[model samples]
Target: MHSDVPILLINLDRSKQRLQSATEQLNQWRLPFTRISAVDGKSLDENTVKRVFDEDNARCRYPYDLTIGEIGCYLSHVKCWQYIVDHKLDFAVILEDDLCLNADTPKVLDQLRKITTEWDYIKLASPYKFRPYHIVEQLTQSNPTISLVRYRQKIPSGTVAQVISYRGAQRLLQQRPPFFRPIDVDIQWQHELTLDTFGLLPYIADNADAPSEIQQLATRKALKQRRWVKLKELLRFKLKI
Candidate 1:
């Protein structure tokens, strides 16, 4: 049962190579998708960044705009939502420029489509290492395992990818709040509020290769200091005291 759902690929205008790799990967997997680029025409100026960040509502707990790289990704997501509305697509799979799919993604997505009605949201087909306290157990023998957890709960594993239904898409559009520092972290934190978000543990674990830029930036030499900064921010946010 092939639905007329669209898959949106978020990419940056300058990162042509990464975009090409992502497209090739999608083609290799034979998944139906459309590519969208977030173009500012001009370079990443401080003014542009501030303008985007300032657009976010201040009422939300997290109200910060994205960096240049992430703004591109978010714009892609926004474009995907717009495409759904314009083309009348029910749902779409939103993939970032950095993520690569595992072999079992097609099968997992197939299964997800079968049980779409049963879920409020369909997260990535990969497994996520969420905080132990945040992991909820299944209460009923339902079709798929989607349990309730805290909205602010943190996940240990990095964000991979996921599929979203029309309803899920609508919810995201409605709550266009500034996410945590990063969009991925915000997605994971807000997953619980949505209907359901699942992870294909084995697939993600097997495909643990980082993007070229990410690998270069997050080198061992810089990792420790970066981690310390991130942890400090996390601790401050969690305590709130």
Candidate 2:
């Protein structure tokens, strides 16, 4: 069903090993997909950085300043969403460079095709650690397999693996340039996207064991310290005495 849907893999130009792994895995499944070259933040000029971090629009609401790698990652996703819109694909599967998929993936994908109309987006990979959900309906009653869910307490995170409909792509395309948040967090905004989102249990796709190039550096730790600086500024703004 979704077998024909275009699949796009986002990989950095320098990450050859990761690209090799992703390509090999797709070969095994005989899944046709396009590999996109990610934007290299290290190459960005001062003007671009200022634009991405504009003070006026409050781009990137993260507690910490976004690392160059993180910025690059976000831009890569934006490129993919734009590709979806440009190609006018009704639905497409977007996968990050590193992911582990089980044999059940094909089966789950087939099930997904059966229920595509029920959702605009479905997370085949469990991006969030935990999120509360109520079973909207069962895909096959036989097993907890593909099921429609209404996430009560959380929105999906992690750009590991997911299916996006054309409408979903349009919603994402609207949020262009100087992003206000990381790609995953921004996508979770249901009001912004206005789409039905669901998830799969016992994920067919999970992040791979390979090291994360984006966060492999001290990205998170630096962000943590940056958070303190931002917090102090916020306190000063609030205290009117």
Candidate 3:
């Protein structure tokens, strides 16, 4: 019942099933959320693409140009950041539709509000495989243990769940249009934006088993490639030329 910041849920309009599933999960935790209509890759217009995405930068930094789905996903998070700035919110917990929340999530979020330190961004989830983390300190001495952790080597993958402050949102937004990296990758490289990033230990949110829309779209496209394309790849690998 004690939440200092609004919870923003990013969901695509076409993903009714994901929205419903995420809704039920949040309700179970008694957490009210504002829905953010996720941007769909398939519907992106030329103007938006040119205005928001930087093809040259993307090719320079990433191995491949970002897919339509990646571009849409990046824009969706940008919308949430814009919302925080426009609405004048102090902070917000942004959740992707595929994230799963546990019982301790609400309490941890409450504890986050009480902390007086200069933390800007706090991650609430990580990939299934565990990674080495530097624990800065525990949130409280009370039950439902959770701690603030700093990443020494790698920032966790996926923007499935995270808490961002007004300042943090503004800093991220300052990067502005013509974004190159994927949203998650962009967050991992947050140092370039001068963000004090951290993650929560005993992560409260996890990725659900539901298939990823982006990956599915990528796979389908790959399957539809010409046979010659597959033959060329196979020949290159076998011949080792």
Candidate 4:
């Protein structure tokens, strides 16, 4: 029900079923959000695709040819960033359509807002656990909750949920279009983007059970690697979150 920090849901118009389900979940929580139509990579012009490919600089990036869905997802989030800049908002919570938010989501967001101005970005829904994150601060001792964490050179997880400020949007847009790497990887290049980023502990959110549009076109080999990465992330999940 907090409206101070605008909530934006990145969604593809084609994913009507998912959108409906996502909408229902959000509505049930009585949380307000804006749904931004995701950029459809399949319909992107050749030149548009070339530009993103030109900007690709991901370390251990996507192995196969970038799928239209992946590209679309990237463009869609960038679009949300642009919206933040355009509206001049204090910050915005960008949630992917397949997002799961529990009752504590509001509390987590409230604690996040306390430090929103201190950071350019904060990952809210991390699928797999990651480590070596320099803990910047802790908000709750009883629950072992972290207020902030430095990624240094690693990203915690997917773009399922995160909060980014207006300045963060500006820094992220510097990467420009035709970004070769995945959106998740692009935001972690702190040295490159100079984004003051952090991740929350015990992800208060996760994705809903649904097929991922981005992975629909992935090759068998790529899928294997993806699973391996997930397994590693799962280990992180067991870290007493």
**TM-score, every prediction:** 0.63, 0.82, 0.86, 0.81
Q: RMSD in angstroms, all models? A: 6.1, 4.7, 6.7, 5.9
Better of 1 and 4 by TM-score: 4
What value of lDDT does candidate 2 attain over all alpha carbons?
0.70
lDDT, candidate 1, 63-175, per-residue tens? 33234545544445656666666676566776666776766555445544444234434345334444443433332243443333323345343433555666666666676
Better of 1 and 4 by lDDT: 4
lDDT of 3 by residue, 1-241 (tens): 5755699999988888999999999898888999999888899999989999988866545544567888888888889999999999888999999878888887787777766667778888985556578878777777767688888755787878998889999998988567876787677666567888888767888888875663234633343334554465345434533
Clashing pairs in 2: 60-180
Write model 2 residue lDDT over 112-177, tens digit each, in one string: 556634566777776447777887766765553667667775556787888887787787667566
Q: Which consecutive 10 residues in model 1 have the weakest lDDT in total?
A: 214-223
Each prediction's whole-model lDDT (CA): 0.50, 0.70, 0.78, 0.72
Candidate 4 local distance difference test against the native: 0.72
Residues 8-117 of candidate 4: C-alpha lDDT, one tens digit per residue: 98877788987887788878777788999888767889887776765343213444355667788888888899999999988898998887787677667767656633
* lDDT-superior candidate, 1 or 3: 3
Candidate 1 segments whose C-alpha is farther than 4 A from its true place = 1-5, 39-47, 54-66, 116-120, 125-160, 177-180, 191-196, 200-241
User: Which ranking of candidates, highest TM-score first?
Assistant: 3, 2, 4, 1
Q: What are the runs in model 4 whose C-alpha is more than 4 Å off?
A: 55-63, 140-146, 214-216, 219-241
**Backbone clash count, each prediction separately:** 7, 1, 0, 4
Number of the top candidate by lDDT? 3
- Quick one: best TM-score, which candidate? 3
